[model samples]
Every structure is written in structure tokens, then in C-alpha cells.
Target: MRDALVKYGFIAVTVVLFVFFAATEPAFAQSSTMFSMLKFASVTAILGLGVTFTMVVGGLDLSIGATAGLAVQLAAMTMVFYNLTGPTAVAAVLLGGVLVGLANAVLIVVFKIPDLLATLGMMFVIQGAKLIPVSGQSVSSGMVLRDGSVAPGRFTPDFLLIDRGFVGPVPLPVVIMLVLVVVSWFVLSRTSAGRILYAIGANPEAARLAGVRVGLYRGLAYVISGLFASVGGLILVSRIGQGDVNAGASSLLEAVAVALVGTSVLGLARPNAWGTLLGALLVAIVLTGLTMKGFQYYHQDTAKGFVLIVALLFSFTLSRRKVRYTPAT
Candidate 1:
């Protein structure tokens, strides 16, 4: 019973939170509120999914938030400055993200920089670089450019449809996030590629000796992470109809928090798309419910931090107990 509780505790907590919020705030039970939670959770889930790819390979993607920010600026700038259409803008930004991933790969794989340090350094570089293109200004329609003239282009309605338009009463972001989660889960759990990644994560040296291309697999993890982050950025900009330079910091912190908490989800004890999505939903529910209750935004991070710590402790304790209980060989 204790083991079961430890293993499934996060799910129980999420259910309790939902029930408590519904009971305390009658409106929280409404379909509108549920949809709102799903919409917001979609972005965090996307980011967490990106981070999960890296984590599965015993790596980290600290630059996800900055990568998202860079993507937003690039996507927005392409449409507004280059007179590019929706698809062109998206393609440009996604390629930019892929480049960022390649850069991280070169730094970590080639130079042998530690994962955390490599990504952390990249986070700062990308964050600063994003601001330079816009002259430290936010990207909005008809905004004044560095040359002192108002920009003419606007975010096309077609592009906006990616996040705003609904398909059969479902939010677009929610739909996209869900579909990507299922696809990613299948790739990670049901394919030979997944087996190789797990083997590399388990022991990179052994995997390489066993004929696995460690550098290629490891670098691809960052590439996947970058692409996912770019998608999140696209959704973010589309939802707001503008690109805000300062958007990346909060996203980075929250997404990382959610991903770390996912490590212990359902006793997986490792990164998984399903776990990341659930963790994101939990974070979103807590924040949304609290905000509806009139809680200040500043205090919400504290609650989120507490929840993460509890999840970590829950997983750590169980792993230790299991190790201690194993009989002598």
C-alpha cells in the first residue's frame, strides 16, 4: 500500500487539487475554466516535452526558454520585416531553433563542455541575442523600427489560427500538444531508436563500444528539444499576436520545474512524455486555480516550488527504500 501510494502519489495529488479547487470555486468546474487550463497547460507541456528528450539521454536543456524566445522573435520578425507569409515565418524560426541545437551539440559534444554549463551559457547568449535584433524592443504590429519608421507588416490571421482557431470545440494548442505527446511517446517507447537512446542514457561509453553512435544520438536529443521549444514559441506568439522579448525567463523556470517533477511521475523514475504532460497539467491547475481564487502572481512560484520538492522527495525516498530492501545475492 505504501509503495503504491508513493508510486501514484502525484496523480492522487492532482485529483485532489482539482476537486479542492472545484469545491472552493464553483466556477472552476465549468467547461470554460477547464478549457482555459488546457490551453495554458499546452505551452508548458510542449516545453517540458522538449526537455524530456534531453533528460532521457542523461542530458539537460537549460536553453529551452531562451530558445523559445529566440524562435518567437525570429518568427515574428520574418512575417513583419521580410513580408513573409505564415508558413515561411514558421519554417524560418524552426530552422533557427535547429541551428541553436546544433550549436549546443558542437559545444557539448565537440568541446566536451558539461551539459548544464553548455546549455546555461547558451541560455544567456540566446537571451541577449534575441534582444539585439529588435533593438531591445518588443515585436508588435506597426511598431517603430530602429530606423525610426513604423513597421508595416502584421501577424497574419492564418498564422494566428495555429493557436487561436479551434477544431471541433478544442483549443488548437491543446490539440497540437496532445498529438505531439502521443507521437513522441510512440517514438520513445515502441521503436528501436528508443531502445538505443535508453541504452546511451544508461551508459554512453558502453553504448558507443556496442556500436551505437553516441554523438549522433546525443546531438539529436538537443535538436528535438530545440524543435519542440520553437513550437511552444510559435504558439505563444500566435496566442498573443505579438512577440515579447521578456517572455522567455518565466517559461524557462516553469518548464524546467515541471519537467523535473515529471521525473518521478507514476514511478517512472525517468523522463517520459506522458509524465511531462501530467506534470505540466498539475502545475497549470495549481496556478490557474489559485489565480481564480485571487492569489497574487508573485506567490504562485512558491507553491510550485513546494510541489516540486515534494515530488522529488517522494521519488527519492522510494528508490532508497527499494535499494535497502533488496536481498543479498
Candidate 2:
């Protein structure tokens, strides 16, 4: 009984916070605000879900943030500098992300580097490499008027539409996020690779003894993480309509927080898609509530930090209890 209560405490806290904010802020429950929150959560959820893959394998990829930024830069450069079409630009962006993941995998698995150090070094490399092509300048498309005259300035209908356009009542980026989330969930829960990943995370030696190719699965996890980060980068580009050097700087931190939080929900100590989804929603709600309450941006960061610390404490306490209550052989 005590174990169950402790394990579920975070969910209870999340609900309480939601109710409290909804009561205090008149606009908290408003339809428009709700939609806006969902939009924000959708993006975070996509990125968070990607990170979950790495966490499930008991590995971490600090390069995901930089990978996302690189993807954005690649996409924008393809369109603006290389004069590539949208589809081609997207393909190149995703490919770049996967290649970055491959590099991380090589360093960690083949070269026997620690996951954290390998990914951290790769993060810096990705950051520097992304800046070289654009010379650290934001890339934007040029305008083409109806008369086929190209405007000298760097703003285009295509670029702006990427950020602001929608399909019917749904935002395109949000729809894309949903599709990715569903795909990620399916891959993680219904596939043999997913089971191998969990087994490795739970016990690498045991998984190896069970005939699972630990190195290959670990490498694949990082690749999946990178690919998902690319998807997030594309959505972010669609949201902002341009490539910013600092585009995904906070993504890694947020993704980590979401993955950790997911571990506590439903007693799922390993990464689960639904848990990540809920974790992302929790973050979005907290940020949205703070914004609605007129809190400063810095205060929002502080609040997030506090929330993360509390979640960690709660999860650890519950985990200890579970370990203690397990029957001894």
C-alpha cells in the first residue's frame, strides 16, 4: 500500500497543480489557451520521446540538442543557399541528423568511449559544424513577387508559411508531431528491437548472454534519438520560419527532464512512450500556467528546476521502496 502511494504521488501532484492553476487563472481553462498549450506540448513531446529511446537503453545522448539545431540549419541552408525544394531539404536535414547519431554510436560502442563524454564532445562538434556553413548568420528565403521579381530582402511567403500556415483547423507542425509520437510508440512497444533495448538497459550483461547484440541495439537507439531530434528540428523551423543558432539549446535539458519524470509514472522505471507524453504535457502545463500568471521568464526556469528536483526526489523515494519490498529469493 505504501509503495503504491509513493509511486503514484507525482501523478497526484501534477493533477493538483493543474487544478490549482485552473482555479487561480481565469484563462487557464480557456479553449484558446488549451490549444496553445497542446501545441507547445506536442513539440516537446516529440523531442522528449526521442530522448526516451536513449534512456531506455541506459545510455544518454547529450548531442540531441545540437543535432536538432543542425537539422534546422541544414534544412534552411538547403532551401536558401542550395535552392533545394522542401522535400529534398527535409530529407537532407534528417540524413544529417542520422549521420550525427552514427558518429556518436561509433565513439561510444566501437571506440569504447563513455556515453556521456562521447555525446558531449559530439555536441560541441555538431554546434561548431552547423555554424560553419551559414557563417553564424540566420538563413531566410528571398521573396518572389507575383510578377516573378525576386525581392532583395530575405523574407519569403514560403518561409513564413512554414511557421504560420495550417491545414484546415489543425496546425501542420502539431499534426506532424502526433504522427511521429504514434510511430515512436509503435516502434518502442511492438518491436523486437524495443524488447532488446529494454533488456540491455535492465542488464547489459544479461542481455548479451541472452544473445542480444548489445552494441548494435545501443547504436540503433542513438540513431533513433537523432532521427527524432531531426523531426523536432523540422517542426521548430516550421514554427519559427528560420534557422537560429540557439534553436535547440534547451532541448536536451528539457528532454532529459521529461525522460526522468516518465520513469516514475505507472511504476515504469524504464522509458515508456505514454509516460514521456505525459511528462511533456506536465512541462507544457507548468510553463503555460506561469506565463498566464504573469511570471517572469526567469521565474519559469526556476520553477522548472524546482519541479525537476522534486520529481527526482519523489521518484527515488518510490524506487527505494519498491526495491525494499521485493521478495528475496
Q: What is each predicted model's overall lDDT from 0 to 1?
A: 0.84, 0.78
Candidate 1, lDDT over the whole model: 0.84
Superposed Cα deviation of residue 133, candidate 2 (Å): 1.5
Among all candidates shown, the one with the greatest lDDT? 1
Worst 10 residues of 1 by lDDT: 320-329
Q: Estimate each model's TM-score.
A: 0.95, 0.89
Model 2: ten consecutive residues of lowest lDDT: 320-329
On TM-score, the leading prediction is 1
Model 2 bad stretches (over 4 Å)? 142-168, 321-329
lDDT of each residue in 70-162, candidate 1, tens digit only: 888988898887667999989988898899999988888888888889999999999998888898888888988889988878899999998
- Expressed as tens digits, the lDDT of each residue in 112-132 for candidate 2 is 887888999999999898888
